[model samples]
Target: MVESESTTKVNVLMVGTGEYTTGYVGGGAADSDKGAGVVALTMFDLRRRNKVSRVGMCGVNGKKFAGIRSHMQKNIGDVYNDMDLTCETFPEDTVVDPLAYEVAAKAFYPGDVAIIFTPDDTHFAIAMNCIQRGMHVMVTKPIVQTLADHQKLAALAHENNVLVGVEVHKRLDPFYADARDRARSNLGDFQYMYAYMSQPKHQLETFKAWAGKSSDISYYLNSHHVDWSEWTLAGMARPVRVTATGSSGVAQSRSMNTEDSITLTVQWENLNDQKTLGCAVYTSSWAAPKSDVHSQQRFFYMGSSGEINVDQAHRGCTVATDAAGFASVNPLFMKYTPTNGMFSGQGSYGVRSFENFIDACCAVNAGTAQPRDFDDGSLATVHTTMQGTAILEAGRMSLDMDGRPMDIQYDGNDHEPIAIVPHVFTG
Candidate 1:
């Protein structure tokens, strides 16, 4: 609890940088490890933003980081020098050595926080250490794989009084924040919503690696759509039942173990036990023009007065009347291109997410921060897992997941006709 007259500061510790292998499909091949991208961006942001002072990075090792450490260690602005947050240096902070995680937890002060930039599987262990040591944590998405694990993590975060938030970029993005605000405003009564996701084939490879053979395509991709729908559509309808139809034509065609195309059919029961507007989503890894795909994300809301389309891929959107007339304009797009600006500097996923978490922790540490918390993360993830599992089963024509029917919502309701059956849906 050290406080100076002018300002107070909180240090951040990070863990699990050991160059990892994500257990990919087709005999588990090796691919690029995640997290470094965010670290590199954070260093650059610190050098440019001049807000935070320094970060204590841990979990890096002697071998994998050997190639890039020299450059990063000198650049990332550690405390070795009088380098405050504004001044920049070279060679990133790998925090290598034997037993870095334990060493990191031991070093964090009460007013300091820790960020975990590792995989989903390592969340509990690394978080447990950080929380026990009186440090807050900002973890990446999908912290835990199953419901049981979610329960444990939630308990730990609260019991420790340490703030824990999962990285869901849209939650923090002004783009989404504005849309959410409007949805609650004159957008009339919020009925149902739809979220669409279309990414490149490589995303599947990335998924198989992190998720392993047992993990399905639906789990990684559709989970995003499902979770967001629950969030935007006012608390996930509690999903009475979910039915899906998927395709492995592209995945199998590529010799991957998961499906490539999946359309989710969700049935949600409104208050008083009656099902209302159905929210259906379709995710495709096989969209036309792979070169131009995944450039953005989009959403649509069905309100009584009018509708809103958050055309995320194109940067922003245009709300129009059903008569196809321009209603109004709200231009909220990224000025920078994905190839450079957003993903590179200004708005990279890892950097933005990591920064938000750190700021949240720093606040709490200084008696001022507000993390999104663990329960929020748990709910989103559980909703995702459940929805994704149902989608995968619908693809395989199975009603079971781990020896169960995978409870979800599915009903035959579509104004424009939704493909509830893959055989019938595809054709």
Candidate 2:
């Protein structure tokens, strides 16, 4: 017999306290788009709905909890009725521990859930720890910086019998989801795709601690479209090569040794027809001037039978205020506004992303579903997203090697990536 949702509610552990997790950066509430955050807010609401129980958050610096709680209280708790801001924080307030997440993970039992939103470099270790403990995990995009780590996580998740999802929220966007379906059903063979996403220059300040030191802009931004393209062309085509180029000066001027803009050009081969090929260009930057929206995201897709164009940043919705001036808003991604003294953004794609993961975890815990059950491409499981990781790592390698093209080699029959090698020249 299957257990009821109320009885099998999964406990959640959030593994980061940065901008995306809490919207509490540096000191107070983020001034950018995510004033209240996506993860914690969604988790709080999930708790309210009885989908989850006992929420906990872990971060390297324990001292930030006081400010984080205050920020959440003001932005989330105080604004929404019955919204609980209660969470167990890792590390004592006076102590700082880089490995505090390990301690936090021990507090939960097997089949619990963890959502990671940390730096690119820390994803592997943190996720590995969680999965090893038999906990389900949902990692932020660009899951890891290397293909080897990605494959390792996939193997370990299977070994531990846990579900591991990559939090590519764009896949849940209504427009993007519809486009993917149309491209798969109506559009013919893949041909070309162009994606551009950028954040304002101020983001460099928020990310200065690890801008180029830990990861680059392509891994930060391009991962979104790369994963989308991979999902869109799954089984239809596979990425063959990646060559990257980057421009600097803005970040350098800001005393950061990182590129201001980066572009990755990838070549894809149709699975059914090897002779036919497709190309995709993904560009990302953090040097964009301040605009009506926090990020400028748009993509163009072409196939043999049809084409698609999407401008996600501008959804034909704009708002003007005395203090904030003019701005374009996307309530579809996250509607932070309250309705009837309650949180009403449950229909948002961002909220759905977390809710979906929680539901999967609960199902697994209830013995109604297995971890591998989610690998059917419905969710961003570790198995289905290997190609995206390969492309992202290859792009980073190309940029580090002065723009040399890298070939993505896959194993026979399995279609899993085996190696990423430099392109060989022949006369």
**lDDT: which candidate is best?**
2
Worst 10 residues of 1 by lDDT: 19-28
Model 2 segments more than 4 A misplaced: 1-7
Q: For residue 10, give model 1's deviation from the true position in Å.
A: 2.5
Every model: Cα RMSD to truth: 10.0, 1.9
Local accuracy of candidate 1 as per-residue lDDT tens digits, 64-166? 4443344334332331233233321112344345446776677556546666656556666777777676566665545544545555655666676666655
Clashes of 2: 0
- C-alpha-based local distance difference test score of model 1: 0.48
Error of 2 at 59 (Å): 0.3
Give the Cα lDDT of each candidate.
0.48, 0.92
State the lDDT at 114 in candidate 1.
Answer: 62
